[model samples]
Target: MSKMIKPWIKLIALIIALPILSYISLRVGVIPVGHTDVLALGSDASSQAMIALNDNRIPRTVVALLVGSVLGLAGLLFQLVTRNPLASPDILAVNAGASLAIVLVTLFGFSSIASFTSAALVGAFIAGVIVYLLSANGGNVMYMTLAGASLAALFSSFTQSIIAYEEGALDEVLFWLTGSVAGRSLALVTTLLPWMIVASLCVLLISKELETLSLGDQVARSLGQNVGVIKFVAVTLAVVLSAFGVALAGPIAFVGLLAPHLARYMFGTAFFARLAGSALLGSVLLLSADIFGRLVLFPREVTVGVVLAVIGGAFFIYLVSARQGVFKS
Candidate 1:
């Protein structure tokens, strides 16, 4: 089957799908809430259904959108910078770095949302810089990915070790490490929105520069775009975007890896179209996964992170195998 569509048309379809899926997500949760429950919020007396919608369901749905869109955009930027289809925050250890930072912050007993967000931004940037330097020859997909994987392993080891020894903060850290948007609050949404908005604006401002950079460093420099500054700002924005996603939902994997492929396959990689398509597709994917997690086992729910990890792992293998000609036959 062919995988091509006009960017606007595809974006329109995804825009339509997102709200429909969001409505379905609200309706198909473990509890019995539905449109009626949402409609009754204006009543003077509050009900259990309304409470669930206000407290639990709505926040998770919003967080899914927040995490998904940012991760998708970051993935696209990662690919543009690395010139590798497989480049993403997850594959490159950005999420793991942010996760380690959050764990360290938690270990110190700083429980504020501001502290968490700041730690994630700093940690993600630092980890991203290390990977960037280590993989300075980043055009080789394997070398860069391995660099990221090594860092991910090292960071995960530290995160796990801390979790093992610090039994006191285990419950909080464990739930956070699970990487689901299920328990987030509107307060968090408010706190994260500003940073996301700022980073997004920066990305938009530099999109043309980035497109030029994608042509190649020499080409970009010859065209008078400041290659170094553009690369630095672009990579920093990507890290910040990935970090915020991790802060919103701990280490949710693959939306960053998977969403870009889906977007490019659909929208043909013209920057703006790819950008919009990636964001919409990512939101739909994560939200759908969250809904599936809720209903797949009835009363018991799987985390969205686990769902994406499985999907991402399979996709990663397929990508590698295809590169090795395993799928040619």
Candidate 2:
């Protein structure tokens, strides 16, 4: 009975908490979003609350949900591929690659979301390739994580240099670097929705292969899986999803790092269940962080990225010190 009840507990808790958190997200902004205003949509209603709800809060929440889900899913895939618990865009420079590309495009006077997103995808793919090749040489999770962290630092230095010299781009650069979903428009969501959908479908299609591959290369090969192709596909999908996340939320830290581990901790390691749990946990973490950001400093809210960094950084330290076996597993 206890064993049977355990599997469904986290799912049921998530289902219950989602609507509640979402309600707080919709209502707890600088400008309160009333239930009446929400219900009044599509009718003859003209109020600041309505505009705030429809234009600002709702879109922000959606982007948070989308970005979080993508990061969580990408992290799960990456960890599976590397057999490394610490593998994630935040730690592995995947987000840094996308961030650098977006910064470059913006500096070149290209401000369109589509252009930024395309550049991000290319940059993320390049980063993924470099990390994989270098890590392949070492053939261990620690070496791979260190390689990724080094690359992330290098990319971040480049990003900061660009922002330093180009004073005019500072404001825009800082906003993205800080990483918030606030003040984003629905147009951003619409622009990235198709790519997100396409990536998700790709995940679903390759999930079986992923499950088999998770069992170790020797086992998977014995099971007739093409190891190289599976790794390539999984890595590519992870990069695409990471790019989408960075494009949406400006390299928000550690959703990828934290979400999958939390999901696996809570739900156990069934491949599909872990994936779904990761997505759900990611959404909760980001949305809750955003809400906390809004309320913590009152009028001067911290960026969601800052909130995540504080939380994730601490969590990361705990993993390193307390759960060192995370890498071995």
Work out the TM-score per prediction.
0.94, 0.94
- Candidate 1 overall lDDT versus native: 0.85
Q: How much is the lDDT of residue 21 in candidate 1? A: 85
The whole-model lDDT of each prediction reads 0.85, 0.86
Best by lDDT: 2
Q: Which stretches of candidate 2 lie over 4 Å from their true place?
A: 6-9, 326-329
Off by over 4 Å in 1: 1-5, 42-45, 137-139, 324-329
The alpha-carbon RMSD values of the candidates against the true structure, listed in the order shown, are: 2.6, 1.9
For residues 1-329, write the lDDT of model 2, one tens digit per residue. 33465666667787687778877888887887787776776675668898788788888888888898899889998988888888998788899989998898888989888898898999898888788788887578887888899999999999999999996866776787778887776787899998887897788688789989988999999999999999988888899999998888898999999999998877675567677788788889999999999999998888899999999999989888897786674
Candidate 2 versus truth, CA RMSD in Å, comes to 1.9
- TM-score of candidate 2 relative to the true fold: 0.94
